[model samples]
Structure formats: structure tokens, C-alpha cells
Target: MPASIVEEFWRTQFATEPYRGGGFALTANPTLEEDRRAMLLVAADGTETAVVSPALAGVTATDAASFRAASAEAGARLHDPDLVHYLAADDRIGEETGHDIRLLTSADEDAFAAFEAGASEQDLDDAYVELDHWAVVGAFDGDELVCAASAYPWDDTQLADLGVLTLESHRGRGIARRVVRALAGEIIARGYEPQYRCQVDNAASIALARRAGFEVYGTWEPVSPDQ
Candidate 1:
């Protein structure tokens, strides 16, 4: 029941121009979108299904138990899952934070650069956060930026994709969650739903999403190419 709100929309989303998975259900999505060779979308309520390419459907399995084996045999190995999160319109938070989190612009280039310079290469790469995006926010300490988030359109849809990064030295203070809540409001104000995605094994990211009041919409992955 938790995913009832998304049923009609997600089915339509997959059936439209780009994806064209017209028959979205617990069964098959007849016409698979090229970009998404195969997808297993498990709704928040635990309802699960797969949208597999017609060419590969015969060998694919929809059940979680056999999905990995079938996908692996077809060259699209299913290893780690990708969790997708969404903030419902009613769940929007309007609370203010003690930290100095604000929307950023090109004028703050140097500050953003210094924040990046202070982070380790490995952490930055894994964070998948960038300074350039449709909407950027920063959490400041006095005048120094320690946490940042970038939001961009996802699949050119009404969903705004978001990524956040907090300096290793500045973590555990709830900066990421506060910054995300502030940004989600901005995304909705701009006429788009805020969407967050992260790998299943990423404990830190999962925690952040939970703390930010985001609900797990689905676990999606490509059947053939990590889809």
C-alpha cells in the first residue's frame, strides 16, 4: 500500500516515449527502453517485478531468488542493488536548521573548490557529488564550506536527482540530512519531485536518506549492464 501512490505514475512513466514498457506489472514490460536493458523495480511495500527486454525475457527470472543467476547468464550481471528514494509531497519538511545551509551560485566558485580540495580523492569519487548542477546547496561552518549537495533533472523527467557530499572531517553532525531537507523544499518549489539514489551496500548513504525523511521507492538495476 505504501507504493499505491506511485503505481499509476511509474507504470505510465515506463510506458511513455523513452522507456515504452507498456505492460508494466508483476509480469512483463513488453517493450523495454533501450537505455534500461532490464530493470527490477521493488516498490517500498516489497512488491517486486522486473522489466526485461523482449530479446532477453525468455531466460530472465523475476523472482529475487533466481534473478541474479538468470541475469548473469545473459551478460547483465546483477551484483549490487541500487536504491532509489523519494520524498512525498506530504512529507516535505519546513523546519529550519542551526547550521548555515544555503542555496549556492556561480559566485561561490572558490569556496566550492576549496571544499573539494579538502576532501580525499577516493571519498570524492565515491560520493558522486559535484559542484555543478541545477541547484547547489552548501552547509557552512563560520565562513568555510564543509558540506554540499547538487540536484539535477533525472531522465529529463519531473524528478530532480540529488547527490550530497560532506567532508570526512565534518560528518556525523547531521549536516547532510539538514542540507538535503533544505534542498528538497527548493526542488518541489521548482515543480519537480526530489529523487535520491545510492548503492545498496552504501550504509552511510542509506542512513542519510532515512534521516532526511526520504522513503525507499524502489531498488532498480539493469539486467544486462547493471541496469
Candidate 2:
């Protein structure tokens, strides 16, 4: 897809102004959070747009003055802040290891339960309730699910947003990476681009995305009302 098309898709999805490449654009209705009320998009060159949804309208710093004013506002805070990474199907690197990785379905409730133990409540809901829209994959250590990954279709587009989680005990064992590779491969086979999103402070997730050959493309900072 063209860069312009990608930008338009995001802008429309968030109900924001047409992205003009650089600087910041503000929108009243952020698609991710119904209660966020306002959003800000920052782009380095103009092709990649980073989303920042503050609880209030004038919160995020577009320039300097707005930022300070936002900071002074009462009950202002950041939420769901993350960096977005895009990976082309052809650019995906890594081999599927011998680990027992398989597609997850509702029948695999036990495995799903184990996987959910490592994921956030919101993610668990997205993975299960919307199971039809996601390609779920799980890695098992014997009978125990050590890691899980899901590729969510992005707004009916040919793009898949990848989310992965691993049991605490399975950290550093490359299980997450393996599961991601398998899931990404499946996504590619289905004719879609895979995207990896990581929180700005999540060092492990960042490292894993890089190792999996996903290049940093953009960033998103979405704030919620409760914050």
C-alpha cells in the first residue's frame, strides 16, 4: 500500500484531520478509546503518524506552549503509550523452531487460560471474544502453554497487528520469539503485512521486534479518561 493510503486509513480510523506528513494534527474522536475525547498525531517527516490521545483536548505538546499548558491541567496523564513498528511480509526474518507451536481455537480453553494468565485483561478479551478476527497461536512446553501470539486484522485492511505474551517463567527462553515467528508467517501466508506494537519503555518487546526483523516505523501515545 502507498504511504499516503496508510496515513489516510489511520486518520479516518481515528476521525482525525487529513495527515499532511509532518507536525501535529488534533482530532476530537479517537477510535481506540471512546472516552479519550481528543487525540494528537505527530509525525517525523509526514509519512508516519504517531497518535497521542490525551484525556482532555489541549493536553499533548504539539509545540512547547501547548505542552506546558496541558501539563498544568488537572487530572492529566498518559495511557496506552506505545511505539508502532511495521514489518513487510518479505522482510520477516527468523526460522520456525522445533517448539510445539499451533493455532489456538475455542476448544483449547485450557491453553487459552494459560495464555491469558500472561496477558492483560483487555488483551484476553480481544483474543477470545473476537477470535474470528484474530489468528491465534500458542507455544507449549510439554502440556503447559508458555507463550502465545495473536494477529489482529487492522480495520478490514490487509494488515495484521501482532500482540504477543509469554509466561513469566518462560521469559528469556525465546518462546515468545518463536511464537511470533510462527504467527507472523501465518499472517504473511494469508497475504497481509504484520505490525508489531511495543510500549516505549518495554525493552524486551523492542528487542524482540528488532530481532524478528521488524523496523520501527512510528509511535502512538493514547491517553484515556480514567487516567
Candidate 3:
């Protein structure tokens, strides 16, 4: 319930998806065709477990302290405590921005690289998280990529994840917002819902998602150090 915990959870999802920090585990991907499991983590008391991912096979605790002790005892093999509080944004929402953003694929490596540069390698690896179930979009300023977004391909039961980044020098032009909306629009067209989640403390990102027509569905908690 604490905002700090909420921010931690969202950051975990961010680190795993667009960044690939290897701090979390993968539950579902195109490669493993089991069942589409809920990525949301829940505590034993029915409270939404914060920071921990549902993909974790062992260890369960509701409170931050218990989970951390168990998680660490297990060699940190559990979900990152900082992963809770990530709010899934709605992809069904749309924006009226008229940017020239469009989808990009493997063939667009150059463009991806342009976006990848100065980005976390963890992101490059997990970029597939979106590609596996979302369409990736890139905004080009002439030949250079300035912004990007990805749409969800899964069902409403699944959470639609969105990530956007702007070239440092190109910030404040609303390019990130345009690309996010463009990708989210595509997801909606596919009959899937889109969700926007960002760190609670990331005022810039939270503002962008809000302006782009996304509302916070729920918040997850993060593991606390002293917990």
C-alpha cells in the first residue's frame, strides 16, 4: 500500500520487460506454450503480493519482510521485491496524436539499434516480451529513431505492457506519447486490452500515460529492505 513499495514493483516489471535486468523470471512466452498464467503476484492472505512475480515456483509470503527472508534464503531466486506496484495501463485507450510512428521488426535492426543505444541490454533481451505479444513501433526523425512503443497481443486476461523512450535531446516534444498511443491503438484493433504501468515516482512517465488516455488499474507492492 505504501507508494514506495508500489514504485518498486513497477520498476521490477520495467527492468524485466524493456530492460531485461534478469531480476525476474519469465512465466509465459511464445516459446513455452503452457497456459497463460496471471503475471500478477498475490499474497497468502489474498492481498496482492508486491514485487514477487507469479512465475516463481517456490516460496510464498504475504508481507514484505517474510517474502524477502524467504526469497533471499532461496538464493535470491525469487522475484525482485522492487517489482510490485507496477500498474497495468489500458491499451484499449487511444490518443489522437498524429505522429508518423509505425511498426518495426527484425528487418528494422538499424532502427531498433537506434532505440537500443543508451538503453539497458536487459531491455534488448526482454524487448521480445512485447514482440512476442505486442507490435513494436518506432518514431523516426528523418533517418534517426527518436521514440518507440509496443502494443499487447494477448487477451484482456493478460496485462498489456507499454514502454516508451525518447532520445535525450528530443525529450518534451511528445514523441514518446505518440508512439505509445500508436502501438496501443494497434493492440486495441487486435481485440486486446492495453495497460500502462510505470514507477510511481516516475512523474514524467506517469504523466505521459495519463495524457495518452491510460488509467491506473491497480498497484502492486515491492519488497522492503527491512521487511
**CA lDDT, every model vs. true structure:** 0.74, 0.63, 0.52
What would you estimate as the lDDT of candidate 3?
A: 0.52
Q: Pick the candidate with the highest lDDT.
A: 1
For model 2, the stretches where C-alpha displacement exceeds 4 angstroms are: 1-8, 11-37, 43-80, 88-95, 115-133
Worst 10 residues of 2 by lDDT: 43-52
lDDT of 1 at 172: 94
TM-score on alpha carbons, each prediction: 0.84, 0.66, 0.54
Better-scoring candidate (TM-score), 2 or 3: 2
TM-score of 2: 0.66
Scored by TM-score, the top model is 1
Residues 94-134 of candidate 2 have per-residue lDDT tens digits of 55876788888888887666566666786455323233447
Instruction: Report the number of clashing residue pairs per model.
Output: 4, 1, 20
RMSD in Å for all candidates:
4.3, 5.3, 10.2
lDDT of each residue in 67-173, candidate 3, tens digit only: 55665664443333212222243224445455657787777777666566756666445333333335778888787777777655323344456666666677888
Candidate ranking under TM-score, highest first, comes to: 1, 2, 3
Off by over 4 Å in 1: 1-9, 13-26, 60-62, 224-227
